[model samples]
Target: MINHILDHRYELLEHIGGGGMADVYRAHDQLLDRYVAVKILHSQFSNDEEFIEKFRGEAQGAAKLSHPNIVNIYDVGKENNNHYIIMEYVAGQTLKDLIQSAGKLSVSESLRIALEIAEALEHAHANNLVHCDIKPHNILVTPTGRIKVTDFGIARAVTSSTMTYSGTIVGSVHYFSPEQAKGGAISAKSDIYSLGVVLYEMLTGQLPFTGETPISIALKHLQEEPVSVRKLNPTIPLIVEAIVLKAMEKDPNNRFANSTEMIRDIKRAESGLLHGDRQNNAISNQDPFATQILPRVSDSLPSRKSNLAPDEKIPQTNLLKSKKFLWGLVCILILGFFAGAFLSYGKFWSNAEVIVPDVVGKQMTIAKQMLETKNLRVNIAETYDADVPAGEVVSQYPAAGTTVKEQRLVTVYISKGGEALEMPDVHGLTKVAAETKLKNMGLKLGKVEEEYSNEAAGTVLNQTPRSGTKITKGSAVDLVISKGPKSRKVTLPDFSGSTLNSIETQLKSLNLKAGTVTEVTSSKPAGTILDQTPAAGTDIAEGSSVDFSIAKTEKATDKNTNKNSGKDASKDTNKDTAKNSKPADAPKDTK
Candidate 1:
């Protein structure tokens, strides 16, 4: 289907990839003049009206999600037997390809990619959309290390029907969640489980579970625990492994509550890794895979059996009456009281105090060094800031200048830079729609220039910085609006002495049409122009038709020729009769 245009808008360029239910093609959107990926449903699924409707509905729902890490669905449509979805064309290898080529990724790289995927899933889940299938194959990795999760709604739509159709499951069996394997209720946690499998594969370069057949692999997902990621790849961090296991829990309840929680844990793990802290390692040391047995309790306590019961009972009463024992106890209590007082004074009241430094607006490293110089401990927290540069402190605890004891923990907030996102494609959208979309995305409309074009009036024809460009929030976007097609006037060219065919061709070249061709008897060659309406050199609007009168060479009348032939026949008959009569008389005498 190369070169085929869908809905007269998307031109199929090349076949890129395919799966069980659809074939993806790289296509060019003619209206917007931009590249897009088109996924056409397989014939088997397209013929099913129910599946088609569900697929369309799910795709539409997924299209509502606008995230940098998620492939955007631009349009959904059907042409004849082909049901297709136009999506953002991401240019890069799949995560599966990257893993295969690199064997396994480093712990830091794996966590980075996994975090991006989780954040994308968090956005999808927030919209109540679950990407039932989350595998390396569906994750696209750009050259710049950006991750984009694709096929958001397709998995949900596929799972809505029997997965055993055509003896195949819609998603990869190795990555299936236990609930999905058992045909149970699917939720956001299902995606978390799949993401865990993806992360596991990314870290280990192998699927967590595999078998000779899809059924065996799916059974493994349902009934077995995957080997520890660290066991497969010793370089993987313990906390990263813990995350994978938690997300892949057999019971959905045991998995992350939602993608947001998973994202938070991933971020925490990443932060710990960056700071070289053992906090996450200590937390992850409690292996989730280990079995725990509760302590047993006794119903009743056994009675005590003492060998010197009588002597021991007598000592308790005698001890209270002994004057020597009382004097010894009084001396010991006075010594203990003095020691406690000395320890309390040294621990809390005698420590030196230092004023917390003003670290706001300072670099994180510099601030930490300054705080540490005063025997103070530094704690870091990061947040996005549009005005402040990254790695700089935005705020600090205790108002930045409070007096506190030595070794006090000071929390400083660092800027992570301005919030950036991929600019959305707005070409062909009406003015109101474009404005509303920009406003919703925290962007502002800059300048709107009007230009005459074939597009409808007020439609966006061009935009500055273009789509897919990385832009910060609140950035201004300029647009060029269409003013509709231009109405142009054309000067009628001289058609005098020109053949009718030439005149017609010239009219067509000028965007004019031949209105009527009238034939008239004239002393000129046939098909030659004799006269023309609205004579030559007259100005006319484009697309106006020009009428023409052409020369016609008339044929001589047939009646005169028929009369001449009849007279010749009559003369020949008279001559033959006279000759025959004379010859009859002479021939009779000779005989």
Candidate 2:
């Protein structure tokens, strides 16, 4: 797809990267005149409705988040089946690459990168969004050491129910939370857990958990605890290790409450390091088995030491009675506790159980009625489905046959049909503006053709499929762009040897004009053209000016002087003849 343009705005320049879900490319934004990253969903997933939803979800969710450490999303669109997202192009390497090259990062660098990632998460969580997928592959680090957390492909909005279905794992197994491994509900703390794993990797140069298979690794996340960061790298401070541990706690409640809290802790750790405060790092330097003095015990029982010195058996009966009374009290408390637990268990067990009816492919209204008839509550969710008709049930929870207690909430997903919108008019707008509008409306730019028209150049003259036509998302719309009015060319002809007036008339007929005319004395007749500025046979635009040189006659005074000189010579000859003949004969004798 290189060289292909998406939405007529982003032109794919080169393949930059690829993952299981999409291929990333460096693209040029024609409208903005800037470079951007374009991620196009793999063709295999393009037709899958579930994948399409998730791909679109990434754009929708990430677009709402704005932070310096979070890559910015500029646009989202599809051309035919190719779904794409335009984002800020980060010219750097992935965190994974950094780890591989360096084997591990310094303590300070790791904390700095982690802190930036946490801040990004803080922003996303504040907007009520959870980034389900956070891993080194998604983290980009610039040459200047700025961190960018990107790839919210599996991100979803925070809601009352955000549980992952059983057997469905959405993120990288090694970096996901324990709750995510168990397909439990996800929250902002999940992102914190993933970030913690990333920090561990940065400090240790290896993943916290590894196995031959994904399932095995996921099980490790659920059942095992990772080795402390300090164990792998002794240079890591105790407080920094503690931060990683807290963020990676198995239970979400045990982890950082949110990214904000995590950020605060990270900042405090950085401060401790910067100030050379050994208190936080002193734990590793302390002696584990150091001895300490104990306080002295005081004598009780009314100076019993001296009074009962002869020892003896004076209070044996009283002591036995007290011991028996204590045992009796313990037994009574145990019995009471069991009784309460039994009663509570029986109360819960007494609720009637009902089978969930099959509602997949049923109309939403009918499905609701059916579930209500079974005394079950319905929780509805809507999603785009190209194969399923609108309002039809796509799937139901609990397998539609599992026994559930009365009043149990059964979530039913309803189809919203194929995503579509009415095409909008883009005529008369510049190419860039037209593409931007179409992309925002979920349309793709199709083949662009240029034609000469009275409209301004680069302006859109017309569009295919017309406005108001309902088109599905990712559908392409062709456009005819204006190249301005057609130009007329004129071939200059030889004007030499032609009269000046005649040349002017010819020029006017040819839509050409005569420029400055210079007069020159030549043998040719007056008013005759001598030379032309553009020579001859030159192609020029219509109405262009052409310079020229014209011939003119010599001055009349010069001809009059030559005639007078000839007459003077003739008179001189006549005088000589008269003197030679004596009046005619006298002049002959003298000769």
Candidate 3:
């Protein structure tokens, strides 16, 4: 229960989140003197040794990853038969809530979320872990807009459990990978596939695939191609759509190899940093016809193997004997031919002249064929040349028309992409100015950091790419703002002549605090204020405390007189009484 603390160390405060297998509570770790999020395994799962082992393994694995975008796991333990994990307590809402509330996000905003998620996945993949669940629900968007990925390795544990039971996918159906839908082995590519689904949902405000049941939805992931993203949001960049489609390809080989590769693509797409060949309307670039004609993927079927004809299945012993005989015959023919031909043609071949083929600007495969026709071998090397498109030969070692010996190797360099330019600084500028500068410089602006400042209040004061610093084009620039001076000024109220109650009210009105009050003998009445520090006209910061002394009227003098002792004293007392009784309103001093 939320009211319960674990091992008396984590004091459960309130219920923050829950799912079928676990419940999360906001709690305070008294030992650490900080707040933490405690996720406890559901009672049903606690008794399962397999589930417990998996959960423990995932927790330990996630604990090894240190990334700003990923939630940090602090501690793991069991108390009173309850298994719990302590993690960072982030005050924010999930990305799902944000997307649902906004309906849809701007291209730039969606790019921001995508990039952050990609970075988190990149780190996890590098550390040999996969999030397995890259959905809006697992991403927390802070008040400042920074994204923190939660439930990292926990998904792997959950999926493992699901895998043990046949015919079930581990993750959410909406973000399932094609392989996942088929209940196949999970890998880093699976995470990439889920990320693609998350990106699609963010850009188009809808899931690419959906159905009445989890199985049906998953089948769509395996068998159906999603509708183009640009169809739903015309403003979606062609490059972004291409990246998403590539990541979500049903064939794992066609998708990114890992989160790092996927992240690189996302970053490039977000920054318009496409390789040259990939430029010029990436959306229109379709998969090659050869790829489209690929043999049916039997891996998608429940039966992991395809049916073969009886004749197609050769006996193992016969197949091995045939392979050995073919190898022996080919070797003998090659030796005899070389022995005879070398004696007659070796001298002529050594003196033979070959013309260098013109292969520059041609695709690598085509260029290689062209070079081979001249009795010259091709040595392919890749380089990033800005002027040449990717997959095209940017340069050749042997210039066109040059003469070389037969079968000589000609080195050709293929272009990969353009050289990246260093990013520039544009901090302290207004939003409009920053946007214009970043666009003009071919750079991208990242999340801005705003805070209260004394100098340059409410204005941009600093940026990630500080002035005069160089960074590659399309790199993110983080901006910082001034929240305004830490304090404000207020004019001290004129409490010199006002009563203590009235002065307190005046101070309250001015947002000033009142200090200790001391009563002292003064000419004014008992309740009236005497004087205040930081005089009335002096200006002081708001919330400053003011101290004043209230007047204490002189106690009536107590003295005894022998008035009734003598007639003379009696006559003097009578004279004083007559003066006092003359008129209560009249002052003795005035008379």
Candidate 4:
């Protein structure tokens, strides 16, 4: 896919951002020689005829919305089956990534980003567009700290088109408005509700609602009230909290009428001024976008044709009567069929009581055999057992030696060793993290060693009990921490037409160590140092030596040695040379 773009007018350089719907690439506009962001519909959507139309339509609608705070759309194009929109490239990170990178930003910074986004929303609202998805992931903060909102009006536009089908939630479950979740009407206030969620996440470093499944989370958004932002961050102003609560109200009417009003309230709160009707009027007067556009309600399920028998077709008015009669007839026929089959296949016998066998002390295989002899099947359920031996039955669901049905299935719990604990994800974590996780898991630190590495200096790396290796709780594990880069003192060796060995000896006097040496063909002599360890200008302690090699004469031929030298030189040309061919004064090789 990327290869196709190399010859394109806008050359895609690298992928900068992506989401469930599309991918954003940093591209160079060959004609203008300027960078532009190219957002292309995901391949999965590109082939979807319905989604392709919606994607293109939404891009067009969003392109019409232009504002300083909003990312400007330049062009929309289709190359083969790939559909893409060119937009102004803003060099920045998304608010979500930034918040993740820097946990819980200061209140002021959070507010600043929020204010810019609100202003952008106000602009969108004025243009008769509502950005249904207003989460932090959609907001970008440039290097200069200026905030810009992308994907304006696209969600609503995409939702309205029947081509995209129904039941597909347009916004993130964590930030969706109650109406959106219920398949009810949406409006500008819906965006405000999403903005409230973003504010909550920025302040708390987490979403308001979370669950194992997307549906569960969406249901929570629809029915539950989020935790207060002030509760997460005490530093947040009361007015800010009020705004958030109001915006997050399940009732759309309860939220701020527009983003402009929210922005005004935020500013007033920051200034420590009480907001009132007059302030509302002032904010409303300044609002550039105040038009009301009712949102279209979407169905909970996409339209699907049910597979029904030919006899199911009935007039609309008589549908219920016909359905009830048909169902009753079918039920009676099914019941009679089952009764006849059972009577033909079974032998009726007198009720006989049998004692369930006691299999507690028996091995699982033997126990299964015993149960099978009595017309019982074993249902194995695995669980962690700290006190029970692995592969052994820990307990049985039904008490043994109890009378039951002949074909009754006995459920047994099997031991699978101790509960497997996942290695805590500790990469890029601080020393405090290592200690906290280790202690929480009843583990202790044995030894801490710091070494040089490109990773954060204090970050944990190699541990004695490597991650995922099961060990008893409270075991002490040695942790190795990165300590930045390695630093060493190297002695300076002189290379004034002296032998490489002599230079190494000089380096040894300075307390420096020697490394590999190489010989270069030079006219100086057969054994003269072209360079020395520690490079001549390096500072080093005394009593250290360096390995040195001399420049060979042009006439000297050692094919095997030269071949080896070439390979070594290719690996690293920093090897020291013999004395007398000091690089500083040695003539450049003519060959």
Worst 10 residues of 1 by lDDT: 287-296
**lDDT for each residue of candidate 4 in 472-554, tens digit (9 for 90 to 100):** 55467788889976656653546658875655555555556566678887878778877766566667654445556668766
Tens digits of per-residue lDDT for model 3, 272-342: 53343244334224423211212367645664124666457644577556988899889999988876665
Indicate which candidate wins on TM-score.
2
- Name the runs in model 2 displaced over 4 angstroms: 50-58, 153-167, 278-591
Question: Model 1, range 236-333, lDDT digits (tens) per residue?
Answer: 76667778989999988888888887887787778767876455454445644322222345534444544556556533458777898999999999
TM-score of 3: 0.47
Best by lDDT: 1
Against the true structure, candidate 2 reaches a TM-score of: 0.49
Off by over 4 Å in 4: 161-166, 273-591
Which order, best to worst by lDDT?
1, 2, 3, 4
RMSD of each: 30.4, 28.0, 31.5, 29.2
Rank order by TM-score, top first? 2, 1, 3, 4
